[model samples]
Target: MSSILRRIFKGKDQQHQIVIIGLDSAGKTTIVNRLLRSEFIPTTRTLGVNYRTVKYRQIMFSLIDLGGQEIYRNLLWQPSLEKADAIVFVLDSADLRISEASKAFWESIQQNENAPVLFIANKIDLPGARTFDTIVQDLDLTRATRSSRPVGLFRISAKTGENFYDAFDWLADVVVGSESVFKCKLRTVILIDLDSHKIWTTKFSSLKNEILDEFNRSISETMHELMKEPAGMEVIIASDLQLVVVKNHPLVVGLIIGYSDSVVRSKLIAERLMNTASSSIEIGEFSSDVLTKLLKRQWPLDIYKSKPRSD
Candidate 1:
């Protein structure tokens, strides 16, 4: 049972309690099914609670999926929220129940203060899905960030599996308790050579050229606007994307990331990489491979803080 496992691994590093809660038809159980079975199946309304143990990246997760109905909310949510090391709150983005879901979301999260929340705007593949920005405003999620809790809002589709792993990967990183800077999902890393007027960039996720061009223009505009002021780092958050730009002498480094948290830590990472690139090579000299390697070293794969033993 999950209780036995929790007692056995209470203070241990390798196991964590992950609680998933949302209103009915919000795709909470469906997401868990996909993660555990890697396939989708028709799910019925959960009557109470479902428990499963999953091993991801060598870490054990005792996933507690709670029913979204009001009766269960009054009875079962508190205990599970108390034990959760990480919490996932799912919302149906295409459904016209924002007011209801928003109320439910605020109610559930208020029960637990310490658990980091992975706020998922699910059903994004649907034609009627709301934008992430709209959902955030409707839910008033900024209040959570202002509280200084490490919360990440991610858009995902349980049916298409789009951005599915990204949501859980962030949850895993937070549950493992890594540094906030290292937990960021870096989508694109760009370095602008101010002296040579050349741009070198690399992307971790598959991104369209238009998106890249937009980021480039935004970075360039920000750099020029800030050129008159003192040199430093700046974070620009628009919708789901976060742009972190660092200016150090002749080089300006920009990082496009998914999470809105960790602005200070991300600036540190960018400045360190900028310093490395500026000292290691000449302006406009960085090839694609060299730039990719440098960025990877600075923002390595977020999982696995230590290697699994061969035994």
Candidate 2:
């Protein structure tokens, strides 16, 4: 009975309705505040629906935050879901009422089948926060999967801003019909010298040693090829793995990223890492500990400085 009007404006700019829903005290409003202001803003329980239009990466998101209380949810959830281009379900990662939240989530999405879903386990910075795997199991998301719709599950802390942009980046990509550029996960980082000899390398996520060795060899080969030119950057995809080789004169930094898609987002991340490396360490003079410190500094979440972990 209800329909969402997706509007297209100028070049590469469009508007989509995004409905944010969850149980009370699930940090829905806080997430919206972070998106709108890009800062931590505390908010109270929503009594009704709050609407705002936010532009992110040239896309206007008509964010409709529906009140999560039982009364308001019974009264307003259907209409909001009916008109949503994407549905964001926020869950309190530390909350004990996950069953209640799960029931509410399933009930809310029953009527909507086409809208993409982004499941965010919020408050990951808090103590006793559930891990991403645990939360996914708790929500029964694995069993109640929607193959027709694209679904993204991410663990994030809106307070500390950890993995915040990564989640939104996926949402933005999916909403715009661009598959997923941000899904490229940082797997391994290799710092090579002008002679193509490895100065230092580290793997983030767990991988088989053989696979890691293969990736290293591929990266080394690519590094050698790039060292021939001694300038510019190149991205190489080996099946699912992505290698971003940057030649900065005396140093060539190779980043092995998982889930090879495109070169744009991964290259930007690699370039930023290069910038950090350039400022933090001198070429051919830093120890592995120093490089490790640099990486931990650059991506606190990836290395996991605290208790929260993103998957």
Model 2 scores a C-alpha lDDT of: 0.74
> In candidate 2, which residue ranges exceed 4 Å CA deviation?
1-13, 144-146, 179-311
The CA lDDT of each predicted structure is 0.75, 0.74
> For residues 8-50, could you state the per-residue lDDT of candidate 2 as single tens digits?
2343455799999999888989988887766689898788999
Q: Give all TM-scores, in the order shown.
A: 0.57, 0.60
Find the candidate with the highest lDDT and give its number: 1
Candidate 1 lowest-lDDT run of ten: 302-311
* Model 1, global lDDT: 0.75
User: Which whole-number lDDT from 0 to 100 does residue 309 have in model 2?
Assistant: 23
For residues 1-311, what per-residue lDDT tens digits would candidate 1 score against the true structure? Answer: 59978876764446688999988889989988876765566798888999988755345788999999888887998999988888899999998988888888888888988889999999998999999989889999888777767898899888866666667767766777674334455677888777778778777776566766777777767777656644655555454556777777677788877543444455667778877787655644677688888766666752123242231
